[model samples]
Target: MTILDLPAAEAIRFAVPASRWDDAYAAGMSEAELLLYRSNLLGSDLTVTNFGGGNTSAKIMETDPLTGEAVPVLWVKGSGGDIGSMKLDGFATLYQDKLLGLEGHYAGDQDDDKMVGFLPHCTFNLNGRAASIDTPLHSLLPHRHIDHVHPDAIIALAASSNGEAVTREIWGDEIGWLPWKRPGFTLGIMIRDFARANPQAKGAMLAGHGIICWADTAKDCYEQTVRLISQAAEYLNTRLAGQPAFGGAAISPLTGRAAIASSLMPRLRGLMPNADNASRRKVGHFADDAETLEFVCSHDFSRLAALGTSCPDHFLRTKIAPLVLDPARLDDDTYLAQSLEDYRALYAAYYQRCKRANSPAMRDANPVVVLVPGVGRFTFAGDKATARIAGEFYLNAINVMRGAEAIGDYVALDEQEAFDIEYWLLEEAKLQRMPAPRPMVGRIALVTGGAGGIGAATAARMLREGACVMLADRDAAAVEEVRAGFARQFGKDVVRAVACDVTDEAQVSEAFAACSREFGGLDMLVANAGIASSAPIEQTTLELWNRNYDVLAQGYFLTAKHAWPLLKAMKEQGGTSVVFIGSKNAVAAAAGASAYASAKAAANHLARCLALEGAPEGIRVNVVNPDAVIRGSRIWDGDWRRERAASNGIDPGEELEAHYRNRSLLKRDVLPEDIAEAAYWLASDASAKSTGNMINVDAGNVQAFTR
Candidate 1:
């Protein structure tokens, strides 16, 4: 493990000026405001440290000394709020005394009755969802200021089996270590009891979780967290000195750092396209640091490469990691597709293990970082603060993990344990508080035959609209590769790729089920997967007819049947829509395409029937028929096109041109983006009142037939 060592002088100080402390205190600090402040601190610190997975809190007091009245309000970080931009009201507030009472009821013996009554007064912001289950722990602590951080140094030691023993050796009596427990009232009780028993202890470590420290001042809490963890990190680094040699695929000596940095300028500019040149210049300056360069170069050949996340909470802003470059892999599209599949599998495995260990599942498993062989790291966040923080923390954690591996054995928290923390009750509660009805925020959606031109385009469109989309196809890997490209271009939450043959009911059903399990629920269905085989009536075969109907007709029926109830529920709650990717072939009587035309016509009728049946339940169903979308698609390639052209006794290029420029009123080829846009419109609120409608997206090709 490469260990990042922090200077000793910076590790032991924990004092903030009284004036600064007073300013924070006087900031009309409501429970919400306090929560946001603590969140920002944790987020900032985590970005600086590596993979800092932890929480923070503040105690707000409502007291009337003369009237002999006092009320303690606990404002704690909600599960999903990124610390860097955590706003007021982002923190969930609960009555202090109510939470403290839960400390008396241990996790093993606590019943639902006891749990419900334990904190009746505890309510999160109506929009924020549930409070962190750690509310109880924060309430029970004596200090008004509290901070919990997962310092890379401490994690380096704590993730191992001998973490407790190592912690004891490093801090001795000054620190305490608590065995990992499911975080909530149970963990709170354990910490409260430990605090009471060890009054002189400065901080406590939750093995496999993180570290916690409290003080009368925010600076004290912050400094203590940084210093203590920094000390442990330095110690580990010293122990590992001169061990594992860092030689791998050596970076070329001729590749100047400046040139590498300059090469990345365009990408960075693209990453922050909205920002002006000056702002981009500032961002570039930050990205060009030596530490950033070293960290980027470190992953050239390491087996377990650090993609660049400091902690899980970073997902709210920076996402998981930077885009990694591998010199051996050059085709960006191909690389993106393959890498996405690898990422999804890893996430699925992680989620399964976590579930087995009795932990709740996370929403999506998209990789935050992309590994590009030679190119430097490309950090992504929703905003600048998150990106900067994530960048800093990624550098530090990479160094520390590398150093630690060099010393003794380095172990990470088990997948299940990590899952438990990731989906802890506190986190779940926080999710519940969002005021906006993102009812389907973590739901799954499946688009069949999604690797085909229109299908692929629709899948990408749905994903960008915030659906955890699964693109199912017979060519599973290829489809997933396309889905992955979309995920990379957008964000991980937008898409997922799964392999399946839509013509096979078993495969289609299985794909839908997998997507549901991965994302928690099934919300929207896009039965856009279909096949087209054109032939003269005399030449059409039973096999071709069966294959076409199986996908274009039976496939849609099966998908709707399985997904109806979920869609009904979503619609009842408002904001749910389904779109069928139909084809202009259904309406136009094209020669030598009897099988293809019949299948699409049947699908169109099925969609209309579905719309009628689903509308009563509030589920809107619509269809879009598009023609001539040949760019970036296999439909225009190989023997399939050759056969079509030969039937017309025309050159392939000219045949395609006639189909596009001559047949359509627009005198232009229809693009996938055009079809995608229609799909989006049908799925959004803009079409809320327009159910049972068929949108034609053919660029004038249909006009000739209609006329």
Candidate 2:
């Protein structure tokens, strides 16, 4: 098949509307926002093609007192955030001169220490965020826009058996392939120095990581990225298409069919929990496909585990590789046990071979893409976006290897070269500078329970923080009324309301899709729409259990599933964060609310698993478990309060006061605003380091009970 027939190649060319630029630029985006938008766009481009395995940047005019009024500023992508939803704050700004100075100060005595001092002079500090490690190189570039993307097709060529020769033939003059150096100022300086020597060169290829392309305009830069990858894809495709092929054969039996599948399925499901059984089956089948078996048998399946990333940034998604599975040789427990040892050995070898004399050791060695011998191939990522990226890289690598086999042999970058690029000092410095951005800005957020109380409060909170929000609820009139009121308060564009039933999957999907289409993409999700029905465990019938699950667990699952692609796309652009509005009952069980408690607990677990699975993709997932957000909620109405008071056998006012006073350590009722504040933090860059964590805004309710 031609390179165009390859999935990675096809995925890479997925067109983003040129109109997006017009929309973004016309939106009067701030300099910071523009930087963020461009960075994210580059990331999205790379992820769709390579799968969360690239970096991007932009250069803007900054006030330069030395130059009198205007000098170019370099705004490069940060380390911790996802490219898909990167905001203006996501790009670290550096003065051109300051970056150039970084190279001159790299003394042999203290590289890291010196690098830390250089960070503050840059414009990145203006926005109160850290700078990217690639800041120096990006600043050194003459171009206005730069994108360092690791297209799977290109990396396949870079890592091929004959990669060096193939690359030389295709890009001898226009592209420069540097011997691998650890990423940071050192690597940046290397590239900068090389580019200085070769004034005409447009970009460079880091032996193992990927390629860097720069140009005078965003379009030119993007075109260059596409051109180089397309050429590489075409070359590999043509080379492979001419080779002799083996017929399909059962090289190995599908052993440990149930056990291996079961163990792996949960992890996969965690990444895509709502994927139908059919989709899950497809992934499982592919893992044990004929090609996987053949590939496993052909290689030193044991030794192949040592390969480093297809590129460095891929670490954000793939996290090294898949666990190896060999059913015939070992039982379930034994197989699981051996996986860690295999991973460690592979990691050790890659580190030892790749580490520079004085640099820190490599962090992970297990291949993000795995071969399971008789089982098949598996790509491990926290989410589908990352999985898809790993899958693309693996497919391209396979094609490249096959082609190299035809051409005599594969020619991967030398071990030393790989190490150098991976540990490039300049690159590491950039990583230390920038912090992650808040999640909701530049995103469309939907709060399902938004018409009243918590949802309305969340909508206002997200809007104030720069998100376009859609408030959704089952009460159509209430939604409309709130929409008008919020529009009047926050301006017409900031908030909208949609009538929705959280229990209906079709409705939830449609609402989310509409929101994404209307406001670019959905980034922050608060699944707060729920009912709190109180009943003893004996009175909780099957219908009650099903009803609670429908709105609580199933609703979250469906909303997340439908929004996954968009969120993944946004994350690939930069980063996306999710906040699930859970209740204290999720962790602190109660006597009367069995169905509610069970569903909430399940939702909490789902959030944790999602956080683990989404991390590699740069999507942060967390839960805000709050207790008794009393003000403005339906439960606080006159009739409802009277009934609740009657049940508790007290005066209505006294019972209400007693409930709030008794439940919390602070002896105060939790306000919707308080919960909103917690949600805001979980959805922002402030919580980038935290995930799979539960933040309690319960006025110490849980703490009081526990104590």
Top of the candidates by lDDT: 2
Residue 309's C-alpha lDDT in candidate 1?
30
lDDT of each: 0.59, 0.63
Off by over 4 Å in 2: 1-38, 47-53, 56-60, 65-68, 79-83, 97-129, 141-144, 168-172, 176-179, 184-201, 242-259, 264-310, 315-323, 329-331, 345-408, 411-707
**How many angstroms is residue 514 displaced in model 1 relative to the true structure, after the best TM-score fit?**
36
What are the RMSD figures for all models against the true structure? 16.5, 12.7
Write down the TM-score of every candidate.
0.47, 0.51
lDDT of 1 by residue, 212-242 (tens): 7787755566657666866776676566454
